[model samples]
Structure formats: C-alpha cells, structure tokens
Target chain A: MSAPLIELVDIEKHFGPVIALNGVSVSVKEGECHCLLGDNGAGKSTFIKTMSGVHKPTRGTIRVQGAEVTFNSPRDAMEAGIATVYQDLAMIPLMSVTRNFWMGREPEKRFGPFKMFDFHTANKVTLSEMAKMGIHLRSPDQAVGTLSGGERQTVAIARAVYFGAKVLILDEPTSALGVRQTSNVLATIDKVRKKGIGVVFITHNVRHAMAVGDRFTVLNRGKTLGTAARGEIKAEELQDMMAGGQELAALEGSLGGTI
Target chain B: MAEANQAAAPIKDERVREMSPLRKALIRPELGAICGTIVVFLFFLAIARDSGMFAPEGIINWGTVAAQFAIIAVGACLLMIAGEFDLSVGSMIGFSGIVIALMTVQWGFPAWFGILVAFALALAIGALNGFLVIRTGLPSFIVTLAFLYILRGLTIFISITTTRKTIIGGVREASEGDPIAWLFGGKVFNGLFVWLADLGIVDTFVAGPKAGQPVVEGIPMLMIWALALIVFGHLLLTRTKFGNWIFASGGDAQAARYVGVPVNRVKISMFMFSAFCATVFATCQVMEFGSAAADRGLLKEFEAIISVVIGGALLTGGYGSVIGAALGALIFGVVQQGLFFAGVESSLFRVFLGVILLLAVILNTYIRRMITGER
Candidate 1:
C-alpha cells in the first residue's frame, strides 16, 4: 500500500521516572480515520501531544509522508500540515467568527511597513468553509461564544481543513458535547475525511469509535493492546477491552452488579 | 460518508438566524457608554446652563482633564483585553516624569534626549514586569502592585538626591528650542483658536504671560494626543495580526500557545505599550505644567481601570475596545466638570461616579444578553 500520511513507530514518552507512553505504534493513511481509544489515564493525551509536536518522544521515530521527522515545536508540526483541534478547539469565544477562524494564521496585506489583516478574505473564506460543513452562519462578525457546542466543533474542523492540514488530530472534540452535538461532530469528521485528510480521533466511547473509525488502536495504561480494522472487532469486545475485562469481571463477582 | 453527508444535506438552511442591523447596533457594549455620555451632558447642561461647560473654554478645560485619564485608559483597555493589569501605570507616569526632569531640568540636557532616556527606561521596566509575571507565574495584579510602591519610592529618592526637593521644576525651559519637544509637549492649531475667539464664539479663556495676550491657545496637546491615540489604538487593536494575537492570548493562553501565537510575547509587548502611553502622559504633564511632583498621578491607576471597566471590559479579560474606554474617560470628565461648574461639592462627583459605573455595567450586561439571545 502507499505510505501512510504519518506514522509513529514505538513512540515512548517519560516524565521523571514514570513512563507515560511506552512503545505505542500507530499510523494513519490519507483519507483514513484512525481512532485512538483509551479510558481515563490511558496516555492518549501524551500520544497526541507527541504527535502534534508539543512534546518530544524519548524513543522511536515519527515519519511524515514516509520521511523521518523530528519536531521541536508545535509550529514545526503545523508547517508540515499537521493541525490539532484541542478539546477547547483553540478558539476565543468572545471574538468574532472570522477572527477566531484565523486567529494565529491571519491573512494580511501590506501597505509599506504597515501591514493590515485582510478582513475581506478572512470573512469570505470563513463563511464559505463553514458552509461546506453545513453551518450557514448569519454573519462572520458574530461572537463565537454565541455558537452551540456542535457548531463550534464544526468551526474548528472547518478551520483545520481550510488551512491545508493533511493530518488532523481531534482530541476529545465531543467529550463535553450532548448527544446531538456528538453526532454533529462525527458528521463533521466524515466530511473532513472526504476532503482527503487523515484524521486521528481520540475518544473513550466505543460506539463513537465504531461509527466513524476505519481503524482502532486500543491503549491501556501506556501500552497499545492491538489494532483492529473495521468489523474485525465487535462493539462489546471493544468496550470490554476498554473496561479492563479481567479486572472488571473479578470486581463484578464481588459486587454482583454495576456499582 | 452517509452519516456525515446527512448533516451536510440542505447546507443552505434558512435556519441560520440573522440579526437586524439595528439590533446589532443596540447590542454593542459601547452603546451604554454613548447613551451615558449624552445623558450626562444634558443633565449638566440643565444644571450649569450659564456655565462654560458646553462652550469652547469649558470643553478645553474638561477635555484636558479627560485627556489625562483617557490616555492612561487606552493603555489599560488594551492590557485588560490581553488579560493583564499594570497597577504601576500611575507610578510609571511619575517615575518617568522624574527621570525626564532629573535628566533635562536638573542636569541641563536637551528635553528630547531626556525624553528618549525616559522612554527606554519605561519600556525596560515594562519588559521586566512582563518577564517577572511570565517567568515567575505570579498574578500581574500583585507584580504591578509591588512596582507601584517601588516606583513611587524611587521617584521620591531620585528627586531628593538630585535636586534636594520633592518637586522637579523648570521643565518647560529645559524643553525650549528643541524641535522634537513640540511633538509631545505644546499646543497646535493656535490660529484656529485665535480666530474662534475673535468671532466671539470662544472666550479668550486665559491671559497670556504677555499683556492683553490670551494664553488660552488651541486644544491642549494632551487632548490632541488623546484623540490621536484613540484612532491609533483602535486600529492596532482591531486591524492587525498583532491585535488578533492579543485577543487570542488573552482569551485562552493555552489555546493560543497551541496555535503558535507566541502568547508570552503578545502579553509582554502589551506591557511595554501600556508603559509607552503612561510615558506619553507624563511627558505632556511635564511640558505643560513645567514641573514634576513626586506625588503626581496618585490613584490614577484605579481611575484608568475604572475607565476601562466603565467602557465595558471584563476585569478578567478578552473583550473590550479603545473607543469604549475613551468615552468612559469622557464621562468621567463631564461629571467632574459638571459638578465643578455647578458649584456643588467636588466630592459629590464621586457619588455621581458610583452611580454611573453601576448603571454602565448593568446596561452592558443587559445588552450582552440581548446580543447572545439568552432569555
């Protein structure tokens, strides 16, 4: 097969003497949805931060487009077309929609030594990109804090795609969302995938991962359990693995019911 | 594809709610400031009808006072938007003024060179303030509060050792014959004021030092600086990439860092900018008044923040405008002069201040709720 868009081989991260991520290998191909599933304290955050270049791996190699790459900062990773939409979506709620859409990477036109942000281009692109995700905002001037959780996630996703991100990492985008909002975010992810971008979906919900994920890499503690292609693993099986099956059964034997 | 496409179907839904232009205008936070200004003006006019509060002299009178707080408020507005505070701003004005005085007035250097030295010092101290907050992770309120006293004490000591007096006088003479001094210190559009006075539209407000001469020149340089800054500050806060960084860093520092905004640098620059404005105010004070007192600019920090808050900025951060803050300063000026013109107790303006601040905040909340469409 063609080389995956990005690959992490046996990545390990350490904080002091404690190991956070131990030899976890994962990869995502172009247009593929690779869901990284783990429960609380499963080191999912560490893995993504490493991938997004916020933290350096103590061991192993990260490859972008089949070439070995070492990222010293998040900007380096972003320049390589990797964008992370953090749980907060990296958005300013009180700012206008267009401003938040182009916060860090704003478009500008120069007038001599004086440079001015190109509000026209920013506003137009923000509206059109948001429309592609089925969100028709009334005005790009509205504050983002007024948007619903679902719409805000869509804005983040649209922003990532608009900025030429080939690898999009969504870290728990739907964690704080309601049922409808989760569905909305899943839909936005699917639209992003069709745009030929690779996605790293991080969540603990088995049903969510099954619904949108093409490949699943289950993590427990700091280690990866295994990888499963679509339909290779059942939803209940994934849930059991996440719940630590053997330990949960022993606790169930003692309590005899849900605690 | 099927599920995601389901959400994309009918992408152009009429469900995208649109607000009318009038409703949009009504929801602006500055709307409160605008209305308050008009109400205060009408109230003052009713009480001080014969007083010069509305005429050219009254305007120039209150305007210069408003300029002092307004200039500082602009700095406070930007700093507040970036999620930081500088209680040392008032002290900065005094300390920098003393630095200017000791350099030029006491030591006999050109005013321009002394002003330049003061600028360098103010920016350096501002950088130190930003560094201490960023490196040590202390709240800016505490950091700057400490500098407030430190600078005040430093100004006093510098004055005592250099000139053997707490007030450094004769700055106007020290600035004389320097071309650059005109940029920051003196009045402009003198012919306009003279013409208006000749037409009897404006009174010959003050006697010039010479006989039969009206010293009441055109608008004070302080007023001109305040207006110019209002324009420049608004554009810098609204129309530049740097402005976006300021909003993002203040809005969510972690998120801004993740997005490569260099949040620390954005905040640090804002500290320096605040110092720059304070330095400007101090320079004007020194040039116009021809002296610097150690006790100059006392309680000006609270006044500036109050102006910003009255302008509808949250003390916590991430939302505000310079125009709003400027208008807030104007409100302060009108109430101050209105009470003075009416011959009422000067302290009664404090009562007016409390009422105005409360009303502005309440109105701001109401407008925000309406804009957000909350029930």
Candidate 2:
C-alpha cells in the first residue's frame, strides 16, 4: 500500500570460498510485518548482519527510504534509524532497569565542574515508557537479571522504540520463549506495526511466521526460494516449501516402506 | 485425562511457597559487610583492652593511620568502581613530595608557591596516566605498573641531581613572620588558606584536648580531608550522570559503548582522579612530617587496593561506595594499631591482616550472590 522503508537488491556476501549469501533480496514496507523464514545455513543471519552493519555485502545495494547508503558500523545504522535487538539483548543484567534504559544517554544536572545523574527524571520516564509497552514493572530500580526472558525482551524492544527506531529488526525474539511467551512476543510485533514502524521479523518457525507476518520470504541454501503474501499462501504450503517440497516428499516416500 | 488431572493438581510444597521477611532480611546484600565490620570492631576493642591498647594515645595514633589510608583509598575506590586500577599512586605521592621539597628547600621558592607547583605537576602526571591508558587500550594494571617504576626512577634521579644526596632529607621550617611560610605551615591566621586547612572545621567542632597535652582535637585535618573526599566521591558515584556512565562502563563496557557512553573519557578521568588523590595525600604527609624522602609512599598502592576490596568493592568494577572504602581503610588502621595494644607480635599482625583480607573476599562474594538472588 505504501513505499518500502528498506529495500535490499541483489545482495550477495562471500567469506573466502564459502558463499554466505547469494543474491538475497527483501523489501520491508512502512507499517508492515515482513518475515524472513529460513532454516539453518539459509543465509538469514548473513542478511540481517549485513543490514545491521555487522558485515558489508560484496555485491548489491541497500536503499533506505529510496536512497542508497553504505554503513561502516552499527552506530551508522543507528543514526539511519535502523535498530537491531540481538538475541543476547545487549543489556547488562546486574544494572538497574533505569540505568540500563539510559545507560549511555543519561540526563545530567550540571553544577560548575560537577555533573550529576538526574535519577528522578530518568526513573519516571523509564517507568512510563515500559507502561506504554504494557509492561507493569514493579520498580525501575530492580536489576534486569531479576526479570524473566520475555520481560527482558520487552524492555529491549521498548528501549529501541523509545530511542526512535524507524525499523526494528528482531533476531528470533520468540525462539527461546515458551508457548504463552511466544504469543506475548507476537502481540509485541503487532504493536510495533501499529506504530507505523516497519518490522523485520526473523524466525524459522513457519506457523509463528504465518501468525504475524503479512508478507513472507523463504530462503533455501543462501538464496530466496519464494516470496508470498499472507492471503496467497496457506501455512501447510509454506511448511512444504520450507521442507524442500518435492525432494522431501520423495525422500519421505522412499523411507516410508522402511519405517 | 490422567495428564490433565496431574496438571490440575496444586503442589503443596512448603519450600515452593514463600520465604518469611526475616529470612529475606538475613539475605540482604549489605548484611554480610555490616556484620563483618561490627565483628572486626569488637575483636579489636577486646584485644586492645587486654593489651592496654584502648589508651587515648593509641586511639589518636590509629586515627592518624586510618586518615592517611582512607584519603587515598577513597580515590582508589572511585578508580576501581570505574573498572580501572592505578598502581602508580605510591610513586605519584613520592614524586609530589620530592617536587615540593626540591622547590621549597633547594630553589628558595616560597612554601605556598612550592605546594602549588607540586599540585600542578601531580595533575599533569595524572593526566598523562589517564591519556596513556585510554589511548592504548591496554589493561591499566600494566600501564600503571610501568608508570610506578618510571615515576620512582624519576624521583630518585631528580633527588640525586638536585641535592647531590640520595635521600633529600627532611623539610625545613619557614622563618617566623614570613607570610608564605605561615600560609603553608601556620596554625590559625584568619586567612583563606587556614579556612581551607584539611581539618579546620573538625578542629573547631571537637574541643582541644586537656590544657597541657597537645590537644588531639575533634578530627585531624587529614581525617577531614578524607571525609570530604568521601562525601565528594559519594556524590560523584550516585548523584551524577557521569557516575552512572562510570558504573555502566565498569559493569559492562561494551553495553555502555553500545548505549553511546564515552567509555574512554570516563576511564581516563578515573585514572586522573586516582593520581590527584595521591598527590593531595603527599602534600599532607610532607606538611605533617616536615620532610620528604624518595620512598615516602612506597607500597601505598597495595594498601589502597586492599582497603577498597575490604570496603566491599568488586575488583571487576561497577559496584562500590566511597563511604564503604573509607570504612575499610579505617578497619585496616584500627586493626594494625589495635593489635599492638592487644600485645600481638608486630610480625603476627600481617597474619591477622591476611585473615581479614580473606574474610573480606568471602563477604564480598556472598553479598554479590545475595544481590543477584543466587541460591
């Protein structure tokens, strides 16, 4: 319905003799959920890493809002409004929630040569932001390690959102979560989409992808196998394609007699 | 149906329910340190009473030692809290004292001017240490260790060249009626310098000792200096944004950098603070002893670090308090002097100190676990 916020064209990456990504391309429209589905060794990791400025593509162009650009570091990506939430969350567990929220960007009260952290303002703002994400944290002073995995993910997402992320790239947000927790994360994705921010949801679970994804791109052996709209494909068909379709079916048939 | 019935059943385990408030309080993070402090204090009191160590003179002597250690330890704590170390503090003190002595006694410079020059030199040295550590990205331990030797060697070379003597001898008193000398060494002259004297406020608050004896007044100027530093350090650590960045950098430097904190700047400033503290302590020592030696503050780095660890600071950085470190230095001072009054052998005091160090490590680890709620 609207122009894409980010579009990768003919992206290719190579490491020595190994080809990590081969002509992988995807487009994320504004306010849309674009799911990248791939199994192990399918080049999803490489594509995301390239997008987040962890690696440079050997060939292809990355256009942000219709303008081609090159990123030298994660800071460059952040400056371009592309925020990535890595699986590890990039949070120090021992620190208080408020400290983690405003770790590098703390509000200061200056007095001559002395500068003090404005804890009162930081704590109030952090709590309010978390509340906006439907997270009712008991205290902003609680150590992040004391929170659950789901809650920690929420905090990271909320932090990214609060810091003015235009495009949020989630690396397997629900991969480690339980059933109910996975549902919670899906709800979070919906909330992000509603905010008119493009979301690139990276996951291998076909059913989970089908749940929140409006458009899907499937990768097989470092290349895109297929791209389909939600209404055009069923979950079973997506699963079949993900499992290599005819080749897997033939193998299953060949092994059916032996089993 | 059987699986559903099993899942529906409520577990009645007492341990899985809830812990009592008393149990929770017992597991508080600060409890271990608080208990250790009290136990150590009582142990010293008991031993001191048995050895006639509770005398007023003994108290005064220990107070002086504690003040010395506490002042430097406060600065060391700040550095460690920011996740760095300064091994050159001992040498910095030696160098600062040497500078003051050479300026005042040899060059015929006024005492006030000598102190000012010495402080400026110290600041330069501090800035150098900070710059090197931040730029190189090497561990502070190696950098400061190298600086310690370099500073010590420089002090020796300067002392030998200036006085044609290896020791440089003691400080010479200023002539009476010399305004500069009075500013540097005088008691009370209604001047800004006197008002800024280390223990001026404490002396006013606490009445002077009995008429004849030199009144061991309220607090030593050195003690007041240490206390003021403690208060300043506390404000820096808790009340400031830079303080938060320091903790974050120490706790997880990568995360701190990811969040846009200037990690290098914070670390460099921390090193400078550590060196500045050493310089201040050196000035106080020169004034108190009325002399300077090439080895004035030898091994003080170890004492400061030990005091910081005992005060509940983690060597890994990110969690500590200046007040805690000052208390730790006080503990060390009390133990050293109290052992003498308790009739303990001087050599055996080392063994007692070793025990205290081990206990402190254990207590620190225990407190960390409590804070993290680890079983």
Candidate 3:
C-alpha cells in the first residue's frame, strides 16, 4: 500500500571468511507485523543484529521512511526510530522498575544551578506505562529481577514504543516464555501493530509467528526461501518451510524414529 | 480497546505480589548496617558508658577514628556499587602523602600548590587504572592489586632516596597560614566550643597550662570531610542519573550498553573519585600528624572495602548504600575505641573486625537472596 517504513535491500554479512548472511532482503510497512521465521543457525540472529546496527552489513542499503541511511551504532539506529528489544531484554534486574525504565534516558529537573533526576515524574510515568502494558506493578520501586519473564518482555516492548520507535525489532521475544506468556507477547504485538508501528517479529516457532504475523518470510541457511501473505501460507506449510520437509524426513529415517 | 480499558480501570492484578513494608525495609542495603550500629551502640552503652566512652572527649576520639574510615568508605562504596574495586586506595593515600611532603617540605613549593599537585597525580594514576582495566578487559581486582604494590614501592623508594628516611616532618610549619591546608588540617567552630566551655556545657581543663580550654577543641576538618563525603555520596547514588548509570553498569554492563549508557565513563569517573577520597585522607593525615610516613596508610584499602561490605554492598557490585557504609565505619571506630574503654586487650579489636565482617557478609547474602528470589 504505502512505502515501507523501513527496508533492508540485499543485506550481506561476513565474519572473516564465513558468510553469516547472504543476500537477504526484508521490509516492514506501517501497522504491519512482518515475521522472520528460521530454524537454529539460520542466520536470523546475525541478520537482526546487522539490522539493529550492532554489526554493519558488508553489503546492503537500509532505508528508513524512503530515505537511505547507515546506522553506525545502536544509538544511531535509535535516532532513526528503530528500537530492538533483544532476547535477554536488556534490563538491569537489581534496579527498581522505574530506574530500569528510565535507565539511559532519565528525566531531570533543575533547581537553581543544579539538576537532579525527577523521581516523581519517572515513577508516575513508569506506573502508567506498565499499566498500559497490562502489568500492574505493586510498586514502581520493586526490583525488575522480581518480575516474571512475560512482564519483563512487556516492559522492554513498552519502553521501545514509548521512546518513539517506528520500527520495533524483537529478537525471539517468546522463545524462553511459557505458553501463556507466549500468547501475552503475541497480544502485545497485536496491540503495537494497531498503533501504526512497523514490527519485525523474529522467532523459530512457526505457530507463534503465525498467530500475529500478517506477512511471513522464511529464512533457511542465510537465504530467504520466499515471502507470503497471511492466507497464502498455511501454518503447516510455514512450519515445513522452516524445518525443510526433505531434511526432516532424512533425519527421521536416519534416526529410525519420529522427531 | 482492551489496552485502553486496562489503563482506564487500574485493577490490582492477581499476579502482582505485594510485599509487606517490613519485608521491604529488610531488603534495603542499609538494613544490616543500621541494625548493627544500633546493636553495637547498645552493647557499648551497657559496658563503656560509665567509663567516659560516651563523654565529649571520648566521643570525639572514636568519632575521629570513625571519620577516618568513613571518608574512604564513601569512595569505596560508590566504586564497588559501580562494579569495580580500588585495592590501591591505601597505597594511593601513602603515595599522595609522600608527594605532598616532597613538594612542600623538600622541593620548596607552597602547601596549597603541593596539595593540588598530589590530587592531580593521584587522579591521573586512578584514570590510568581505569583505562588499563577497560582496555585489557582484566578484572579490576588484579589490576588494582598490582597498583597497590607498585605505588607502595614507589612511595618508599622516593622517600628513602630523597630524605634517606621513610618519614618526613616539618609539614605543619610549611602549611602554616596556608588557607587550603587549614581546610584539611585545621578545626572549625572553635569559638562555639570555647563558648560552650565557658557556659559549663562542655568539660574544660581544670588545671595546668590548658586550664579553661575545652577538652574537645572543635569539630576537626577530618570529621567534617567524612560527613560531607557521606552526604555527597548518598545524594549522588540516589538522586542523580549518573547514579542510575553506576547501578546499571554494575548490574549488567552489557544490558546498560545496549540501552546506550556510558558505562566506561561512569566507571572511570568512579575510579578517579576513589583516588580523590584517598588524597583527602592523606592530606588530612599529613596535616594532623605534622609529618608524612611512607607506610602511613597501610591496609587502609581493606578497611574501606570492609566497611562497604558491612554496609551491605555485594562484592560483585550493583547495590550498596553510603549511609550504611558510614554506619559501618561508625561501628568500626566505636568498637576499636570501646575495647580500650572497656579495658579489654586492644588486639582483640582485630577479632571483632573479623567476626563483624563475617556476620555482615552472611546478612547481606540473605538480603540479596530475598531481593533476587534466589535460593
């Protein structure tokens, strides 16, 4: 429909003599969930890391809002309205929820010549934001480590959205979560998409990806097999594509059992 | 619509566990130190109260000793919370004192000039320590341990070569009338103490050359420095964004970096601060003693860290409290002097130190487990 919010064209990444990613292209439009499905060691991590500016692609053209850009650092990517919620969630567990919420970008109030962090504003903002994510924290002063995996993910996602991320890249957000947490994360994705933000959902779970994903792109061995719209690809077909039907059968036969 | 409804109607979520206020308070980093201070105070009151340990002069005695520990404890507390250690702090104190003595007494520089030079040199070495740790990715314990020996050796060598002795005197005369030296070595509120003595509010000398003079002169600059540093450290760690960065860097440095925190800068600045505190302690010591000894601050670094640990800082970092560290120092000063007041063997003070440190560590472990929900 409209021009994609962000586009990565012909991305290639090499580590020394090893090619981690080769000629993989993906794009996300406004208010759309683009799922990148891959098995373990399918180059999903390297691809997302490159897209998020942790590593520069050896060859690629990245476009944000139809303008060519190069992100030299994670900060640079953030400046371009691209935020990545990594798998580990990038949270300081021992810190208070409010402190972790406002870690790098703390709000400050000035008194005469001195500036101090605005704890009142920070606490209130954190409460409201966590509430919006359906996480009613008992206190903003509670340590983040005490939160569940699902709640921590919600905090990270809410932080990315609040910071004006136009294209949010989530790396395996539900991989370590329980089934209920997985559904909660999917619901969060649906909510974020409704707010007109582009989402890049990377996961190995085909069913989880298919739950909220509008468009699907399968990555196999550093190359994309194809891209398909929601109804065009069934869950079974996407699952088979991710694991590869022939390879599965071969492994099953070699093992003399179902896997 | 669901999100809007959820935000509009703030229901107490069933999943969100609420902690009792008592449990919450118990998890505070200062809890152990606070409880320990109260217990220690009560114990001493029972045994040493009639012995004049609670009297003005005795209070000042232990207070001064506590101030010594508190000054460096504040620095060590902040640095440890930032996920680093400065084992060289003790040696830095000795090194800084030697530098000041050499510059002022031997090299013919002014006291104020020498003080500034000592601070600059110490801070530079501190920066180098931070740089090496960051660049080599070495554990700070090893790096600073190396510096501890390097600095101690350098101080001794410099002293012996220059003056043919390890101790240098005449600093008091050289620093006489120097405004900066007075800030470190001199007393404050002298008129107030004298007025208190005249009003019979304080004990005064009843005979001899010092008759009518109050036994406790005034609040020494050392006590003031300790108090000021404690306040400054407490506020900085609790009420500032840099404080957040310090916690984040210590908590999970990689996570902090992912969020764009300047972890390296926060750490380096903390190292420099540790050096600054050591230099302050050194300057005050040199002025008070009217001399500088190459081995003056021997084992002071361990004392500072012990106070911080007793204050409930994790050895791995990410959590601590300055007030707690101050209280820990207070306990140290009191027990060290209380032993004498109670007529116990002075060497038993070491036994007390060892026992208290073990107890604090055990308490801290339990508190950490409670907070982290770990077994």
Candidate achieving the largest lDDT: 3
User: Which prediction has the highest TM-score against the true structure?
Assistant: 3
Q: Quote the positional error of residue A81 for candidate 2 in Å.
A: 2.7
Candidate 2: the clashing residue pairs are: A116-B240, A116-B241, A117-B239, A117-B240, A117-B241, B171-B291, B199-B221
TM-score of chain B of each: 0.93, 0.82, 0.96
lDDT of 2 by residue, B1-375 (tens): 442233234334353435576865664433444665687789987656755455434566787788889889988998998889999999999999888888878887777788788878887787788788878988889999999999999998999888977555445563224444433333432343334334443133234453322333334466667778889888888787888888887887877776678888888888878888897788778776777888889999999999888877879888777777877788788888877777778888788788888887788777766555334
What lDDT does candidate 3 reach at residue A229? 91
Per-residue C-alpha lDDT of model 1 across residues A62-162, encoded as one tens digit per residue: 99999999999999999999999888755778788899999889999997889999998888778777877878777788888878887888898898898
Q: How many steric clashes does model 2 contain?
A: 7
- Sorting all predicted structures by lDDT, with the top scorer first, yields 3, 1, 2
Tell me each candidate's i-RMS in Å: 4.9, 9.7, 2.4
The true-versus-predicted C-alpha distance at residue B36 of model 1, in Å, is: 1.7
lDDT of each: 0.87, 0.78, 0.90
How many residue pairs clash in each candidate at the backbone level?
1, 7, 0
Ranking of all predicted structures according to DockQ, beginning with the best and ending with the worst: 3, 1, 2
Docking class of 3: medium
Score every model by TM-score. 0.95, 0.81, 0.96
Predicted complexes: DockQ each: 0.47, 0.31, 0.59
